[model samples]
Target: MRTLHWFRNDLRLQDNPALLAACQQGEVLPVFILDTDEPVRSALGGASRAWLHQSLTALDASLNNNLVMLKGSAQTLIPDLCARYQIEAVTWNRGYEPWTIQRDSGLKAALKANGLSVTSYNGALLFEPWDTVKKDGYPYRVYTPFYKHCMANLATRTPGVLNTARIQMVPHGEQAGLESLALRPKVAWDEAMLMDWTPGEQGAQGRLQHFLATGMGDYREGRDFPAKRSVSGLSAHLHFGEISPHQILASVRAESPADDNQTHFIKELVWREFSYNLLYHFPTLQEKNLQAKFDHFPWETDETFLKAWQTGQTGYPIVDAGMRELRQTGSMHNRVRMIVASFLIKNLKLHWHHGERWFWDCLVDADLASNSASWQWCAGSGADAAPYFRIFNPITQGQRFDPDGAYTRRYVPELKRMPSKYLYEPWACPVEISRAAGVVIGKDYPAPIVEVKASREAALAAFSEMKRRAES
Candidate 1:
């Protein structure tokens, strides 16, 4: 039997159920299509595109250059390829995004109608969004309950499938190569990203092993500190499907004893699952407020403030550092991500969409479900969102989490010599200390764009108005 395996997010070979199924059946032709028909909102971001370019190159090399790269509409391309190759069956790992779900369903129906076998396996997530639901059969809205249920009902994980069968390649007649996708940027803006990341299955496995050895023991506490290496740094790999969550979970279970740090790490992974659950059930998660009262909330539209926040001149040391770090590295510390997000929504009074869109374009680990849910969580407009009154104070957050100022100073170098006393709040630095530190508040580093206390009050007032309007 001749089968074609379509590679979407699941890019790796090992433990890939669909790919393994294809290989075991008979001669398997692996193919990846960069679907151009994706809606603007669902389209791959700049950083994600760059990562995909490198990831696809790695995958192709793993296949011994047998991976067929194609572009344009998958709806048109897949069927055409199946017919051309005389493929007996089509297999793919499922994607949970609303667009992808719709596309796959339609494509699957079309393929079956034409008397071809079509099968899709769950490869992206540990649990299908529908599997871990409330007793009432409705999807979970709050995370704590969802986490508890998932943990209590944790199933025995199957080992990753090892494909010992030789992968047979289809004759490459005229498919365009990887470069034809133009996933890399026209300018050399990706040099820093290239230096920091190794985008492939090997790289993903290496990261997991490294995190297990060095980070997992202290993960619970050290993860909060931006300067620490407690994070797995496998977010991009997971987002790209270079590694499966099952593999990570199994590895963690086998490698570490059940401890607070291990439990916390598992909970963090479950949070990603929660985001997908929300996305699967609530398709408008990326656009509309999950909590409807936010519809009446007053959001300020100030291009000046937006630009300041974007360029990391917010004058809030921690916020600036996080934003600058995102620009330079295409990633940000999770704790700092919260700080920056809170500053944008609560302090600047900007809509969370701004932050979500920016992160979508900038972050390498920018998963749609997590990005949208997190931005909404920060804005207090999502399910299990933070309370509107619980705004993050950038100064205090910096003082607490990034206490040593190492993470801040690395991104915001003007504050390199500023004493810890005023590292987070440079505007409050003494004149003598400022001169000694060779940094000027308004000149060298920006002064705080908005006063924290006043902005907090304004945000509360806006929230009250939203409630008032919603009630009326």
Candidate 2:
């Protein structure tokens, strides 16, 4: 009996449910397909492909340097590989995004048409998204009760590992070359973003070890502050499935019997799970608003505002800095992400979908679940979205999350020498003071494109009218 373990998003060898299940069947043929159907590489960026190539290269090496990397839509290529290799059964972890759901379903049918057996496992999330629902079995709309139900209802678990020694190695297909697959590599990208971070199964284990040893203790307080190295930085690893949420949750649970930080971090991981649930239940969310009322909610379709936001030219230091960080590194701090996204949707009155689409293109950490859920949350449109009227004042947001302005200065070099007091709202600096500080408004940097106070009031008024209309 021979089984092929199809690596969709889950890339790691440890605590991988699908890979383990494949081991139980026979010689595990681990494979990763370069999915072209995904829009990120084609439309807005090359940075993701560069990152993915590196990640896959790293994985190929760790699996005794024997990973089958292929291209040409998984919808077609998967069945071809199965027939050529004479695969008896195909096993893989499940994917939840609507497009993936459809694509995987089609691939499964095609494989079955060829008289192949299929097995799928849940390695993506600690809990399946749709499994945890209300007594009425309806999908969760709000996060609190959803979270409460997850905590109270789900059974306790510790992480499990895949023991390769327990498996019979497949001697055939051992000579397949990765480069023969023609997976593209190396684009003009920020080397620092890829170099500064870790990748692959080995890197994931190292990160889990270090976080549990040094970072997890203070993660609760440190996660919100950008200047603090508090976040686990496991996002891209999670995105590529190099690390499983089960491994993370199990490790956190093992370290402290009752640490609140461990629990908080686990809940955040569950937040990832909840996001996947939303995507699974409401497949239309990727393109359409979950709340249909937003379809008629007049949105200011300003490409200029979007350009300013995307290129870090909005003149609000924190928002610009966050945008710049994402442009340069393809990632952003969680808190800053919210503030910057809110600025686009609420302050700029730009459509939330616009920001979501851009993030989908840029963020290597971008999960369809987290990305869609968060953007909708900011726009007050999807399940558990923030209230429509509550707008983020960019200056106040900077002062609050990035109190010392350490993060803003790192990405916004134009404001590197500016005083911390004005760092968050440098457009407020007088021209004379700015010139003396060698900060020329139009030359060194741009002025605030929109007045913050005026924008907030306008956003609130629009929300108020929309609310009244929705209520009516």
Candidate 3:
């Protein structure tokens, strides 16, 4: 019997249950569909597209150049390929995003109706959304209880190791290759991202090894500081299925099972699972506010402020640094992500979706579930979100997180010579100090776009008004 292995988010060959299962049955035809036109899932943004191009290239090479690449909707293409190749079964790993789950369900039903066996395995997440639930069968909404439950019942089952020796590849049908998909950007602005990442399984493994050796020891103390080399930087790799969460967890458990840092890393992995769970239970997560009261919250939609925020010209060092880093590297530190998000939603009084959309376009690790959930968390519009009145002070956030001006200096070069006292708030510098630093507040670097004290007060007043309106 011939089987077709459909690769979606689970892009790698190792530790992939569906790919492994397909290989075991009979001759396996490995295929990937570039569903650029799918209405259910939004089109891949430029950074994601660039990463996809590289990832697909690496995947094809790993398959001995036999991976069949096709472009179109998976619904019609899978059946057409089966008909053409006389495929006996179709197998793939599952996806948790609302549209993908719906698409997979319809495809499974259609294939089964035609007498073709369909198998969907969990390859992306450590546990499927439905695996862990409350006694009444509903999913947990709060992170603390949800994480505790997951930790208590955490399975030690490691990801399956693929037997490459037994693998056999089927000849390509309706031949195409990675370049045919046109995933790369037409104008070419990815030099920094190219320097920063290697988008494949090998790169993911290398990142894990480096983190364990150097970064994991101080992950707890240093993760909040953007200048420190404390983060895993494996987000894009994880998002593209280059690395499995189980593999990451197992690696940590083996090296430092008793260490607090290792435990914290595991909690972060569990957080990823938690976001997927939220999206699974609340299918409208990306489209609507999870907290209904937030539906009445007023949002100022100003393009000028939005553009300034996007371009890293917000006149706030920490905010600008994070935005500039995102544009150049296609990723940003976790702590910076929160600070910048707070500035956008609360300080500027913009809707969370605007920032969410911008990140969706700019971030290489822009996951639908995490991006939406985090934005809502900042906007106080999510389940278990931070309160709306808890506005972040951009100046202090920079001072606290990027102390000594190292992070701000690296990304916002104009502030390279500014003193630590005025690094985050250059407008506070006296004329002599600004001159000595070879920087002018309004000329060389922008003054603070919105004053921190006044903006915080305005944001609180707006929040109060939103509550009043919602109650009325």
Candidate 4:
């Protein structure tokens, strides 16, 4: 019997349950479909598409160039492929996004109705979102209980299978190549990204091993400092399913002794799971505020400020650094991500949607669930969100996290010569010091876009008005 394995997020051959299942049966046909018509939030951003192009290339090579690439609606294409190839069964790893869920459901039904055996496996997440819920059977609305619950009931997973030797490729004539998908950027903007990342299973495994050996020891404290190498840097790899969470978890548990750093890393992984849980339970997570009270909040519509924020001209060094890093490297440090997001939503009084959309386009790890949930969390409009009043002070955040200014200066090179005392707040540098440093605030580097203290007061006032209006 011929089986078809539709590759979605699970891009790797190692530890891919659905792919393994397909191989176990008979000759397997591996296929990938690029459905560009997905909803705006679900669609692949430019950075993500570029990464996808590389990832698919790597996956095709791993399959001995047997991977088939298709474009257009999967609803129409999968059945056609199955019919053409005389495939008796179809298999795939599950997707958690709302659009994918709906699409997969319809496609599954259509395939089964046509007398094709279809099976979907939980390959993306360690545990299905529905598996861990409140005792009352409702979904979790907070992180602590969910984490405690997950930790208390940690389940053992079967080891990832390597079935390459058994995977007999179903021979077919040449189809469209990976380049025909047009996933790479049309311009030359991706040079830095190419230098920064290796998008494949081997790369993901190498990253995980390197992090375990070096980064995991100090991950808890050093992860916040952007200059430190404590981060795993596996987010883009994970986003593309080049590696599995189970693989990471198993490695962490086996290789390292239990410690605060290890625990913190595991908790961070759980946070990803939590984001997926929220997305799964609340389908409108991408579009609407999970907390309805935010609907009454006064959000500003200032294109100039939004554009400034997008271009890293906000004049706040740390925030600008983060944004610039995103544009340059297709990734940003996590701590800086929160600082930049807070500056955008609270200080600028812009809607979180603006930041969300921007990150969706720029981040190599631009996941639908995590991106939406994180932006809303920063805006204080999401599940377990920071309180609206708890705004981040970008200046203090910079001094605290990037104290030596190494991380900030690397991206915001205009302020490279500024004194450490005045690095984060270049606008405050004395005239003599500014001249000595060969930097002029408002000329070479922008002045602070909005006064932080005044913006905090204005944001509080707006939040108060929103509360009053919501109550009334």
C-alpha lDDT of candidate 4 relative to the true structure = 0.92
* Whole-model lDDT per candidate: 0.92, 0.80, 0.87, 0.92
Error of 3 at 445 (Å): 0.8
Which of candidates 2 and 4 is the stronger one according to lDDT? 4
Ranking by lDDT: 1, 4, 3, 2
In model 1, residue pairs whose N, Cα or C atoms come closer than 3 Å (at least 3 residues apart or on different chains), thus clashing, are: none
lDDT of 1 by residue, 140-246 (tens): 99999999999987764865676544677667675598988889999979878768789999999999999999999999989999999699999999999999988
Check candidate 4 and list the clashing pairs.
Answer: none
Cα misplacement distance, residue 464 of candidate 1 (Å)? 0.6
What is candidate 2's lDDT per residue for 1-472, written digit by digit as tens? 7788888778777788778888878876777876778654223244555567677888777677667777658877777777777778999998887667787888888888889998788887767877887889999988888889888865546656777657664554534466554434445455766767677777877887887777788888988888887888888888888887767776677676567787788788778878888888887776778897787676898888889999999989999889999988888999899999899998899998789878987777777778888899888898988887878888988898888889998998888878887787676787777777789887788888899889989988887777677778
Evaluate candidate 3 by giving its C-alpha RMSD to the native, one decimal.
Answer: 1.2
Q: Residue 221 lDDT in model 2?
A: 91
Write model 3 residue lDDT over 310-402, tens digit each, in one string: 999999999999999999989989999999999999999999989888898889988988888889999999877999888888888998988
User: TM-score of the candidate numbered 1?
Assistant: 0.98
